[model samples]
Target: MTPTKTIVQISSILEKLFEEHFEKKVEEMEALAVSGSDRRYYRISGGGSVAIGTYNANVAENNTFFYITELFRKHKVNVPEVYKINKDRRAYLQQDLGKTSLFDLVIKDGFTDKNRKLYHAAMAQLAKAQWIAGREADFKQCFASKQFDEKAIMSDLLYFKYYFADLQNIQYDRSLLISEMELLSKDLGRVQPQTLMYRDFQSRNIMVYEGKIYFIDYQGFMQGPPQYDIASLLWQARAQLPAAWKEDLLNGYISTLNELHVPRMDEIYFRRGYVQFVLVRLLQVLGAYGFRGLLQHKAHFINSIGPALKNLEIFLADHPQTPAYPELRSLLEKMSAPDMQDKYATTRGSEQSKLTIQVSSFSYKNGIPKSAGQHGGGYVFDCRGILNPGRYATYKHLTGNDEMVRQFLERETRMPDFMNHANALVAINVEDYMARGFEHLDIAFGCTGGQHRSVYAANQMAEYLRSRYNLEVTVSHLNEKKWVLPDAAKTEE
Candidate 1:
């Protein structure tokens, strides 16, 4: 097919697919070529702003991408707004991400320190995306259709082996390699599972527009190793950042992880992240070189092989004690010998789960809390009475008589202080309370009479707590009999 004809065909397919879903017409279409695999990109101008359409039927279904994109947007990440999707046709319309990829920026000599700072900021945003998605159960539920467990990891490994090893005419004991891979898989499985792995997280797949990073080519997201994404960033194909910068970036990632409540994420996980980096890079290099380069004549993949190998060597030499070092080093050494060809197992059995366990502790004193506490636990601090308090008043005033009640009621009640104190107490007694948990906590507001002061205070306090703290709160008046009605004979309205 001619290039123009092919573009028309794909554009028609996309237009038809989205129109069927959203009942909209495509006003303008301009194609762009910067994506991997068989996907096609187009700028569809219509509906207020132009929408970018990504059509990749083979790698991912349309609806899946649409849903995932919406999820990312909902979690406050800057995902292109998904206008429409047709799962059957494998096409969708999204908000246009402008005409700039980080790849383009770097090529144009736009790699200023300011840009680098922006990139790190973008990385921080990526971290937030991971954090929110990782904690969600529904996010994990979405990947039920995909088998990304140990077997899948192994399958990817096998893909690498098939292309890289076979191309090099290498042969080794498959059973032994499989055995070692099985052990490696077990170790990996123990690392900690989190939702939302943007399977291809690299500079090329990120776009910089209006001083923010926009994520693209993210349909391969899954509930897998968190380190996978981090590894992808540190060992990206486009830029070879310095070790100190990488460390700083990794530290930024850790901070984001901590904010999101991922457990036990210390230096150990950092080391594990490096290991994951090597593994993923190895897989990508092998797969890209074998499938894209050898089979499809994609020169980019072929060119990447030397650099990939060099990187692998550097990583292996640096981390000699890693479990996969012996097998990898031996394989590399054999590959260097002209006559040696090695065949290795690419798949392995699922190992133990690797989720970080986080627990929070709060202290309580005399059924009230004195301070905020979280031993890796999530806590919400609410500041009440900071805003308008009159809106929360529950007791209406009497016009005449009952001056005492009016004075009492007119004085704003001060229960927020007590409630905060109560919350502090709850925090302190968290452990003890858990041992013998109480069903409810009722803090009463009382004055000279129940009518004015107590009721007003109770309302004010409730409003304050609700606005400020991340806790369930309720307000109630303990006394209300002091105030005389404006109309005694008739009931007070």
Candidate 2:
């Protein structure tokens, strides 16, 4: 693929920074995935160390991140350390916090005990950042807007209006909706700003490395009531945290804040602010997903729309008596109607009860297996890229599922990397499908012969999907005539 001009320019800066910082030549620079923002990230590995090289067209945002990182580090906030930045501030190098985002861990592990512990720790850290680090931050050095005041609040609400609701062409009294938004903004802005509100605080932006939680993408932080940050964390759409878990985390956050002794915050006051902010955050996120997914045609963001709309439904249903904004509430309810849901459905069978994921291993000679259900055409992965174990005499009789064959493939071939990439690809689709209530996915792996590489890859994928997603997964090996019991796919709802 041809590198874009901006990426090429950023790469040159990364090379220069690497040479100056480590006094060693750059060996490799690989562009990382694009994120929600315009910022581009590259992983630079050289001089026995790795760091992240980032480029963003928004120089003001870049300066805010640099300044906040420095200030927050002094205040003991857990953020990646900045190493070097370009003179123009278009690109910079920072510590690489590894690839395990909290979101990834949650999806892979499910809401496990250890994951909950990490979340509590994250909440504690968040409290400290909001209170201590927030108090010390230089407001003048803040990016774009220094505070999440009435204007900022209105911008987010209007973003939802123009980008999301308008794009959907939902019918509403526009003037009434605007008036309600004005009232809502005033109600939210009435609270005195006390802490640093991490505008985008959520699991995806939180990185877990070396058993520690670190913050990222926080340059958008602003001076606002801490409740905004709380809403951002607990009401995050994709996370889909249980209401009880949210309450526990919120209480823990409150306890941490009390320990800091910054100010006495009563539960009633805080809860009121928290609820309103949840509404605001959901609107902002829905607007973002609509613009990025529908407008820009990004698959990941498009996939996220269902979960976000679900969040909106839950919030709106819970608060039926919207005395502050009846028109706004009705508008949101109409936007999340069945017609709108169908418009954003990524695949057919998205209205089904439960999704069935069939994982099969087949030989190239025999051909790929067809999906069994109404929803046809799913993922077909070619696993022939790795070195073939079938070529070795010792492993000729062993299948990919055999313990010896599995170990051999893991050690000698690029099977682990290939499998990891495959897992990521399937995971993206599975998450979207699950959120949209899709049923049945057929994932098949093909190799030179189904007995070795393809069988092993298929078994791994089956186990991963079953454990990670708790979805109904059954493994079938076509060439070997080994098939899982038919009852294996009948999982409890």
Candidate 3:
């Protein structure tokens, strides 16, 4: 489904859930920013109660999250409470944990004693969670697999290989690299599943609400070494955690685990696994940055590539295991060079002359589409004022590209005035940009569902610009994947 429609439909579902569970009407619902996931989060407030409502099409993952949250609550783990779940399990509402994440805390107060205590508090909870939940939580309830075993390890390694290493065109012995990765995966997989591993245990997932640190986003949690979670947090590239904090926190986590859990974990065994998992976690993230940044061209992910590279470099210099994977080591060292680093992350301004206009249609519910230009300059027209065909059952399933939907907007609504005024504003910008020898221009149309009015306006505007101006024009509907031609014929404005 289009993100616009997804939001529109899910909003009602969530509001109904709030009224049913909270025993009050939903007064306000605001979309929350999400990162690298299709899941939608919203801040829902109603009659003296508030909650965070979530929607994801993945039913299994949703059930797993709700199930795990219940388990964590039983063990008194510092996670938000899950309240109501839809019958099909595609949506749910949970306690609102507020917006202050641990990463936000670290960034605001760097290297302070207070922040040290907060980081330590985060470590303490992770220890309790891993020790208690690992044994008690049922592995049968996990979403994908029970363990972070060889297969899971290989998936992460291959992701790094294909998306990050291979996409960067890094010259490596592919067979040898794969062989080394397989060996590493098998070796690491042999570690006994001792405790609950918070697969994405990082500062950002750790929220500081009501002056206490709480964990969030454990839908990916599974049976694995506790060392993995520690590695995930301490080595998070964006956190820029001090070396002393890394050292102190590792020692502190181990200390807490042994002090709390019976049948105390072997410190020696943990340190060894810590090294390997740290390697695995870093490479996995590089792969994520590669796909989200390099392939998808997201500004946040693209900006993160350099710091990830730096983290890998520091590991190569310091870690003793660097020599074991000679082929992997060779690739990392080559990519670490200043020249190669620029090749992956630097902004490209190579094309200087030809003007290219990118027009997009999106939903206000999903936020605006970001401009790809370096200056972040663009024109965004709110098509909400134009009548929406999505409200009608006839145009409900059909997108703005459908001939009937186009006719509905063209004949039934004020879309012509909307399109005309939009074109006039953009035409001025385009002519001025061309005269100034500028290279790119971005224009977006946003409506309620990004389906009818905005989509139709974008298509009409794209055609209008193409006919009137001698320049390249590309159009897209940001919420949906299907690319359809404008069904109606058009002439130059």
C-alpha RMSD for every candidate: 26.1, 11.2, 10.5
* Every candidate's lDDT: 0.54, 0.79, 0.80
The C-alpha stretches of model 3 lying farther than 4 A from their native spots are 1-5, 344-493
Which tens-of-lDDT digit does each residue in 1-493 have in candidate 1?
2232233355677777656655667676665654244566777765554677766645334545666777778888877777766545456677777878776776576546765675677677777777775455244334334424676676667777777766775567677776776666666655665546777787777888787888877776777666677777766544655567667777777776677676665668666755764565566656766676545433355445555555555555666665454665576656634232111111110111111211111112112222222333323222233222223222234321233222222222343344445444433433233335332334443333344434444444443333222234443322223344445425744
Q: Write the per-residue lDDT of candidate 3 for residues 295-401, one digit (tens) a residue.
A: 54444665567777877778878885653889988888887777765544433222323678899999898998999987677799998988777775556767887
For each candidate, give its TM-score against the true structure. 0.59, 0.70, 0.73
Ten residues in a row with the worst lDDT in model 1? Answer: 341-350
State how far residue 395 of model 1 sits from its true place (Å): 78
Worst 10 residues of 2 by lDDT: 484-493
Q: How do the residues 42-66 of candidate 2 rate in per-residue lDDT, one tens digit apiece?
A: 7888878789988776788899899
RMSD of 2: 11.2
What candidate 2 gets wrong by more than 4 Å, as runs, is: 1-5, 342-493
Model 2 residue 16 distance off true place after TM-score fit, in angstroms:
2.0
